[model samples]
Target: MYINGSWTDAEKKQTMEVINPATNELIQETAKADETDAAKAVAAASTAFPGWKKTTAKERSSFLLRTAAILREQTEELAEILTAEMGKPLKEAKGEIGLGIDYLEWYAEEAKRAYGEIIPASSSSKRLMVLKEPVGVVAAVTPWNFPVAMITRKVAPALAAGCPIIVKPASATPLSAMKIVEAFDKAGLPKGVLNLLIGSASPIVGELMRSPEVRKITFTGSTEVGKKLIEQSAATVKKMSMELGGHAPFIVFEDADIDAAVEGVVNSKFRNAGQTCICTNRIYVQKSIEKTFLEKFTARVKELQIGNGLEDGTDIGPLIDEGAVKKVQEHVADAVQKGGTVMYGGEQASGCTSDKFYTPTVIADAKDSMLISTEETFGPVAPVFTFTTEKEAVERANHSDYGLAAYCFTKDIGRANRVMDGLEYGIIGINDPIPTTAQAPFGGVKESGIGREGGRQGMEEYLEDKFVSIGNIE
Candidate 1:
């Protein structure tokens, strides 16, 4: 699909094979875009920028809502391709598309809500106001794990804010993102308003970030990569919002419902095989409940069925690739050597050699000294440890260099509030596993990330502010 105002054959002949990790086979293929194609896409976006930016908020909002409808209508196709291309469970993939649609619809309505504030002027003839405007051309880079949703989370708002966008989706899973762009085109988005180039990140991203026409960037990926992006973006001094790596802390209080805590950790940690940036990687329970927490969590972990993502009722799917599998294994082995106990599903599977499924693992007696508890494992490994007091739990959760989302369970409202306040991470939940919502802000502190991604906060990422003053000319 040629998104940059025209449908022309790609310049390069190279291509990327979309591989299904579940079966380790090629699913589909697309031309690997060269730097020339990247330039064409940005140029198309630059040409469209003047008109898109000049569009009234109401017109932009209407087009965004139409795009949302198009996304909803094509969700099934999007989900099937996501499962085939990225290896997420079909059901979860479907849900991810739904979330993508919701983000667009949410932002469509939000466009109307955008307001200008009047600044007090010292004199009657002098007037001042602050206005929010789209940040010219946006270069959005999204990861593969949650391909469809992450793209929508960034692209939807930029369009809603009246910005022409140029997207660079992950090379591993570009099909799902491609389908989304197809949806936008079908929805009749104006020419060059939304465009994308897929292939080598070095060629695509380097050129886009350095382009004078590209005014801002919103990225979701590794912290190391994000740091590099920040440095590169400095060259143009472009606007940037980064959602990087995370080491989420899942804390269980003694007063918590043991069954609920076990279920919460298993569901959130194993979903996507722990590929999420905010997945619960560290489990810190009150010393009194640690014994009970491990017993229940481990039992549940053993019952999960690992299989192909398309299989009905499959609880777990393959890691994105061999690198993720190796990383999870290394972390587990390191923890075991450091006195960690594997009560269930710790070893890699040899029985299913053809498949890429890594068993959901439960580690007990884990400590901060181990890599599993300190690093962002980014796999289906949940390590559990004990804490003596509120102060201790807070300190333990904050010990990591990365701080994204943190979770805690307690019926005591006061203690829940305290945990919410004391935790150093960006997003926190009390008795709730998923803290992300369309109405509230989501992001991280420290190495986890630099800015928020959801709710009203995300809209602000794609926009810039300007102040206008009118003085008396008497």
Candidate 2:
């Protein structure tokens, strides 16, 4: 772990092995930090916060721009490490690195635009000004999926807003986060401005939350975990931004082009082996075109080649571990028991090196009562249900406690507008399956998460507004 602008071992000198999920082989070992290390990192951030907040926005942006260039130059090396640690395919891994670069570049420019406001006062002699200031030290905890992108998503905005950050990356994927820290260090980032640590979540998070110097926490992971952090951070009342779990629904209306819908679903559902938070979990098709949609969607799913992530022409890779495979199996069995038909690829693959390779699956005649419908199926399984009308589709899609992202396909602008407004989600994709970008506000409502991650809204989470009034002056 890189802490206080230096590459160092854990205080306890303990280490953990990083395994390649594709082959279940040991890739490398990383330092395992404890509460002591967490304190060191947090103290480093706190010590740097004052000077970092004093620097001009353009000065901070220069470091971010340099880091972005370094990331692009080392894309191949970083993508390999990411794919080996997490089971995403090499192509997707490269795309993730590119997305990380986009975040750094976008936030670098967005930092310059963190504008304050001048409010009009009732009295002629009174002047009111609102100033934006950094919220101080930040604790950033990111998850395993989209390892690099999630780290950049949190760190870029925080750094751009002039807050020093201490990162606690997911233990399952720390190497990717370490690589990013290295790039930032090489870009001449000030000492102690950014810190990284790897350890158990509870202890590290507890240490950061209990410290009064840590002013904010940004996390991306499961909703249950987010809630726990919310409870833990209550003592200090830290500002928080969470991008939690999602069970996104993809609705294909009768008026939509069936082929285009199939293509969209294929791209969104199978990317990263369906491990992303915004991937399509439930498919709602109009009853009139249910059969047609299933046939096309299943046929496309069958063509996805599953193998090692580093291998060329591999469409999908293994799950992160055996536990993920078991979860996918359990969901499939429950859906099958609930009368859902297994259309294609329901079981583990035959010729894979490990049992972690679950085949790309498609389930038809699915109902909302099944476990797959209610919970997030973070695997290569698609459980599809049919709807009779637009109202029924919207009702079923909004039935879940999660509302991160939702998608719909329609040619009629009136129907599209109606469904978009009716769906309860943070992001709505109309004929576009992948609705996330560095330029847009990325977050969810309800149980999905709190606050946003990208765009101008993301910078606000790390800033505090201070009101100043001047009277009887001039």
Candidate 3:
């Protein structure tokens, strides 16, 4: 655990063993934090906030820029540690590191651009102005998938906006978070400005929820947990940002380029072995091109090599644990039982070092009655559903409670605009599968989430507005 500018153990000196999901081997034992440690971190952040927020924007920008430089210098070492702990492919892990660097660099510039406003006065002797100030101390909870990217996305903006933060990363992937904090500390971050706690989620989060010192909480994880946080934190009325579960729908219209659509679906659905919050969950293809799309898509999925992330030429890695494997199996069985056909690779992968590996699976003629249709499988399984008309496709895609992300592939410009408008998701990709970038707002609507990350809006999540009115301006 890292708290108040130093690496320290929990007050009780407890530790938790971290296991590599791919090989099921013990990697290292990390310090385990409890409620007492959480309170100490909160106190530290609160103590640091008054001075930290007083620094000029340019001064804050310099610290963030320096940290980004350090991360860029140690990309390879950090990437390997991330893959070893998180089970993402080495190349993908490197890409995540690069993305983290992008966020830090982007927010460094945004630090200087948190613009305030000057409003017209009602009288000649009066002046009205609004100022942007840091929202005191923040507490962040990040998920296991995309460990580096998730932490950077939340922490970069917090630091750039001049807030002291305490991060509680998922126990499954604490090393990546620890490494990032180490980089910031190496770059000369001030004491108590940034802190990290690793341990059971209940005690750490419970402390965060009950502490009135923490003015903001940013979380990226499941919807169930997000709700619990909301319920617990209602007493303090802390500002909260929640990026929760997503059940994205991938729609391929008949006019879409079949080969390009196939490639896009494969990239969107299977990257990180289908565990991403925005990955395509249900693939809908027009009846006219259904057969051609499935053939090419299945071929591409078959070519994905599954093995330990450290091994060369490995594309897909193991699920996070045995329970993940069991969830995939259960979804497949339920789909097959409800009139879905198993196209290929629908069993536990053989010849792998552990039982945590599941073969890439595809199910055809999928219906909404199946478990895979409504629930997020969070595995390498693609369930294909066909539609006859554009209206039906849009209607079906907009039916889910989750409104995080949805994708549509079509070459028709007019139809593309229509479909893009019709979908209810927060982020939509038309003819392009991967649409996330540092310059655009990324979040969801409805039950998916509450606030946005990325773009100029991301920094706003950590800021508060103060309106000042001055009289006798003469």
Candidate 4:
């Protein structure tokens, strides 16, 4: 764990083993923190808040810029650590590092643009001003899927907004978060400005919620966990921002280029073995092109080379753990039992290095009633459903409780606009597979999430607006 500008152990001197999902080998042991350690981290952040918040935006941004540079310089090393711990292919791990660097660099410039406003006064001698200030100490809890990227997404904005943050990364992937902290520390971050704790979620989160100094809580995880945190933090009434679970839908219209749609679906679904929150879980294709799309998609899915993340030319790697594999298997089984046909790659891979390996699966003739259709399948399984009309496609896509991301492939301008507007998701991709970027607002609607994570809005989550009215002034 990192706290008070130095590397330190937990109060109880306990440790948790970090395992490589590819081989289930012990990578290293990280400090396991409890409530006592959480309190210390919170105290350190609270103590540093006053001084840190007083610094100019430019001064704070300088540190972020330095950190970004260091991250780029050490990209290979950090990517290796990420792949070893999280089981993403080396190429994808590098991409995650790139995303982390982009967030730091983007937020560094955006910090200088956190502008306040002056409102027109009704009376001659009155003045009204609105100022945006840091929301005090922040507790950021990030998930394991994109460990490094998630940390940067939350921490960069908080730090850029002049708020001190204490991070609790997923227990399964704490080492990547620690590496990021090391970079920021090496870049001359002020003492107590940033902290890290690795442990069970309940106790640490409980400590943070109970602390009066901690005014904001930003989390990236499941909706179930996000709801519990909201309930727990009710007493403190802390400002909360959550990026929760997603059951994204990928739609292919009859008018779309079938080959292009296949490529897009493959890229979106198979990347990171579909562990991403925005990965397409339920695929809805227009009946006219359903056969062609599935044929090409299944072919591409089978061609992907699955192996250890460190190995060259490996397209897919193991899931995060045995539990993730089990969940994927359950979802696939449920879909099949509901009369869905396995188009390709349904069972676990035979020649993989670990038991966590699951074959890229594609289910055809899937219905909305299937488990894969209703739940967020955070795995490499794609359940393809056929729809006769645009109305049916939209209805099936919007049937879920989650509305994080939705994609449509169409050549018709009116159709594209119609589907884009019709979907309830927060983020939409038309003709393009991956829509997330550092400069865009990334979030969801309904049970998917509460707030945005990127773009200018991201920095706002860490700030509070203060309205000042002056009378009898010059």
lDDT per residue (tens digit) for residues 381-427 in model 2: 99889999899899999945899999999999999999989999999
The stretch of ten residues in a row with the least summed lDDT in candidate 3 is 394-403
Task: Give stretches of model 3 more than 4 Å off.
Answer: none
lDDT of 4: 0.92
Off by more than 4 A, model 2 = none
Clashes of 2: 0
268: Cα error in model 2, Å: 1.0
Each prediction's whole-model lDDT (CA): 0.84, 0.93, 0.93, 0.92
lDDT of 3 by residue, 1-474 (tens): 888999999999999999999888999999999999999999999999999999998988889899999999999999899988879899999998998989999999999999999999989999999999999899999999999999999999999999999999999999999999999999999999999999999999999989999999999999988999988879999999999999999999998999999899888888898889999999999999888988988888889999998999998999998888899999999999889999889999999987888888989999989889899899999999999999999999984689999999998999899999999999999988999888788999988999999999999999999999999989
Residue 339 error, candidate 4, Å: 0.9
Worst 10-residue lDDT window, candidate 4:
392-401
Cα distance off (Å), candidate 2, residue 308: 0.6
In order, how many clashes per candidate? Answer: 0, 0, 0, 0
Candidate 3 pairs with clashing backbones: none
TM-scores of the models, in the order given: 0.97, 0.99, 0.99, 0.99
